[model samples]
Target: MHVPDGFINTPVSVAAGVAAAAAVAVSLRGARRELDERTAPLAGLVAAFIFAVQMLNFPVAAGTSGHLLGGALAAILVGPYTGVLCVSVVLLMQGILFADGGLTALGVNISVMGVVTVVTAYAIFRGLLKVLPPGRRTVTAAAFAGALLSVPAAATAFTGIYALGGTTDVAIGKVFTAMVGVHVLIGIGEAAITAATVGAVIAVRPDLVHGARGLAAPLKLRVDGRLVDAPAAAAPVPAAARSTRKVWATGLVTALVLAGFVSFYASASPDGLEKVAADKGIDQKAEEHAAAGSPLADYSVKDVDDARLSGGLAGVIGVGATVAVGSGIFWTVRRRRTDEPAAAEPSAA
Candidate 1:
C-alpha cells in the first residue's frame, strides 16, 4: 500500500528515507550478478510489467480491493535485488507523476512496499524451494505462497510504523487487526496473480526465469521397484533460444495492453489501506498530495473529459515512462558489471 502524507510523522519518515536509500544503494551492487547482457534489459521489462499489473485492482471484500504488489512476481521472474529496484521505480513514478503516493511519504512506501515485501517474499520462496521437488511446479507453488504471505507482512509492517509515528491518535490494536485481516484476503489475489504470471513465463522460456534456474535438472526414474538416476536430459538450451527479441516484444505488448486498456475494467473500489484508513479514522489527518495539481494527477490526464480515454492514456504513459527509467537505471548497473573486469586488470604496459 502507498502510504500518503500525514500518515507518519517527520522523524520516522526521514528515517525510512535513509533506510530506503541505503537499501537501494546496496541492491544496485547486489543486482550485478543477476543482470547480464540478456537479463539486464529484462529487468526493465519486469518493472514495466509490475507497473502495468498493479493498475488492475481486483475486489477483495465488500468495499476493499487489492492489486498485485509484484514483489514476489518480480523476484521469481528476475532476481530479488533487482526486484526491489523494480518496485521502487514504480513507486517513484507513481509519486512524482501520477500523485498516487505522497511525495513526503515516498520513503515509507518504498520501505514497506519495495524493501519489506521483496526481502520477506524472496526469503520464504528460497526456503520453500529448498524442501520442495525441484521443478517448475515447485517454483510456481513457492512463488504463490511467498506472494500470499508478503501482503499481510507488508500490512503488519505499516501497522507498526503507524503505531510509532501515526499522525492521528488511534488504537494500534484495531489498526493491526483490520490491516492484517483484510490484507490476508488481498494476499489470495496476490498469490493467484503471482503464480499465474510466473507459471506462464516459466513455461514459455524457463531459462529467462532467474529464480527457476536450478529447479530443472537431470531426470530421475523408478525402475525394477527401485529408484534410479536417469541419463541427463538433452543438451542445454542454446543462448539464442533463451532471449529472443520476439519474446521480449511480445511481453512488452502484453504489458502495454494490460495497463492501457484492461485497466479500464478493473474494480473502482478503494484498496486495502484506503479502506482501512477510512474505517478506522486513521485517515483523519491525511493531507493532500503535493502533486495534486499536476496535469496527470490521480492517473487522469488534465482536461480529458472521457474517463476511459484519460485513464487509459495515463496508464500507457506510466508504463512507457517506467520502462524507460527502469531500463536506464539497469543499463547503468549493467555497465558497472561490464567495466569491473577491465578495471581489475593491469593497464597496457
Candidate 2:
C-alpha cells in the first residue's frame, strides 16, 4: 500500500527512512551477485512489468480492490535483492512523477512493501522449492504460495508500524484484524498473477527466471538394466548472443501494450489500503501529497479533458520512465560486476 503523509509521526517516519536507506544499500551490494548479462536485462523488464500490472487493480471486496505488490513476482522472476530494488524503483517513480504515494512516507512504503514482502516471499518460495519436486510446475506453485503469503505479511508489518506510530488513537487489534483480513483476499489475486507471470516466463526462458534457475530436472537414461543420469547439455546460447535487439523490441512492445492500451480498463475503485484507511479512520490525519499539484498527479495528464486519453498517456509515460530508470540502475550494477577482477585460476600443477 502507498502510505500517505501524516499517517505516521515524524520520529517513526524518520526511523523508517533510515531503515529504508540501509535496506537499499544492502540490496545494491547483493545485486552485484544477482545481476548478470541475462538477469540484469530481465530485472529491468520485471520492474517495468510490475509497474504496468500494478496499474490494473482488480476488485477484492465490495469497496476494496487489490493490485500487484510485485515483490513476490519480481523476486521469483529475478532475485530477491534485485526484486527489492525493482519495487523501490516503481515506488520512487510513482511518488515523484505520478504523485501517487507521498514523498514523506516513502520510507514507510518501502519498508512495508519493498523490504518486508521481498524477504518474506523469497524465503517461503525457496523453502517450498527445496521440498517440492524440482520442476517448473513446482517452482510456479511455490511462487503462487509465496505471493499469497507475502501480501498478508506486508499488511501485518504495516499494522505493527502503525501500532508504534499511528497518528490516530484507533484500536491496534481492530486495525490489525481489518488490515490482515482484507489483504488476505487481496493475496489471492497476488498469487494468481505471480504464478501466471512466472509460469509464462519459465515456459519460454527459464534461464531468465532466477527462482527457476536450478529447478530443471536432469534427464535420465536406461543403460542396459540400470538407469543413469544423462550427460548435461552444453550451455544454451545467451539472449544477447542470439538477438538482444529482438528481445528488447518485444519487451518494449509488450510493456507499451499493457501500460498504454490495457491500463485504460483498470478498476477505478480505491485499493485495499485506501479502503481500510477510510473505514478505520487511518486517514484522519493524512496530509495532502506534496506533489498533488504536479501535472501527472493521480495518474492523469494536466488539462486533458478526456479521461481515457489522460490516463493512457500517463500510463505510457510511467512505463517508459520506470523502464529507463530500472534499466539504468541494473546496468550499472551489472557493469560493476563485470568490472571486478576475476579470481586467478587454480594452479594446474
Which candidate ranks first by TM-score, i.e. highest? Answer: 1
**TM agreement with the true structure for every prediction:** 0.95, 0.92
**Best lDDT among the predictions, by candidate number:** 1
| Candidate 1 lDDT (Cα, 0 to 1) | 0.91
Which parts of model 2 are misplaced by more than 4 Å? 219-247, 342-349
The parts of candidate 1 lying over 4 Å away from their true place are 218-237
lDDT of each: 0.91, 0.89
How well is each residue in 1-349 modelled by candidate 1, as lDDT tens digits?
8889999999999998999999999999999988888888888888999999999999999978999888888887889999999999999999999998889899899889988889889999999999988889999999999999999999999998898899998899999999999999999999999999889988888888888996776556999998788975479666645655766788899999999899999999999999999999999989999999988898889999999999999999999999999999999999999999999999888
- Model 2 steric clash total: 0
lDDT of 2 by residue, 1-349 (tens): 8999989999999999999999999999999999887778778878888898899989898978899999999888879999999999999999999988879889999999999999999999999988887898999999999999999999999999999999999999989999999999999999999999888877776767889886787768999989899996698665446544455567777877888888888778899889989988989999999999989898899999998899889989998899899999999998887777543446558
